[model samples]
Target: MISSTPTTVTDRDFATEVLSANQPVLVYFWASWCGPCRLMSPILDKLAAEYGDHLKIVKMEVDPNPESVAVYQVEGVPAFRLFKAGEVVESSEGAISQQKLQSLIAPHLAAPN
Candidate 1:
């Protein structure tokens, strides 16, 4: 379960990892009690591994990361924000399809050589 998965952005590392990082970052804002959030976990995990070389994927709990959630203006659970060069370039909210989610990040991915 992604709940058990670690290596995500904490309030402590958000600045360096997402805001100042050299690569694109995908932030999944979710809550433990949210059903849709739970459902989106595995899909994100798969995409994380698939896109690891070009993009960084991280999970942020809405319950514990109130600052980030509010800062991003997330109105719903299972929110995804794609950040590049320290700015949000794209965003989506809800339990969306894997294809739709992939489409969201595709443009941000580095082209294969």
Candidate 2:
């Protein structure tokens, strides 16, 4: 069964986990200290569940994953980047509603089987 939980990603395995993923990936860049980041957790969880099979959702803690944070130029928590075929196809930052998050992924998700 596919897991809805967002896989924890770090600079160490970012390339393999996100960049090389078979499906499109939505990378959530968050920091523990950010209140907004905490608020986004459940919304992200929901998205992970709905799109788990068609899209990959991964979380990267900014503090420990400097390489990716820097590479992605994520200066704030709760930033999102959607990647397809090893390229960024869409991106957004800040705390956003579930509907907004869905819009970000909807374009990339494969039609349900």
Q: How many clashes (backbone N, Cα, C below 3 Å) per candidate? A: 0, 0
Q: Candidate 1 at residue 102, lDDT?
A: 93
Model 2: per-residue lDDT, tens digit, 7-82?
Answer: 9989999999988988999999999899999999999898888888888899999998888998988988889999
lDDT of 1: 0.84
lDDT of 2: 0.90
Candidate 2: 10-residue stretch with minimal lDDT: 1-10
Worst 10 residues of 1 by lDDT: 1-10
Error of 2 at 70 (Å): 0.8
Candidate 1: regions farther than 4 A off? 1-6
Candidate 1 clash pair list: none
lDDT of 1 by residue, 1-113 (tens): 22323247777778887898788888998888999988899998888778777788888888777788888998999899999999999999999989999999998888977
TM-score of each: 0.91, 0.96
- Candidate with top TM-score is 2
Best lDDT among the predictions, by candidate number: 2
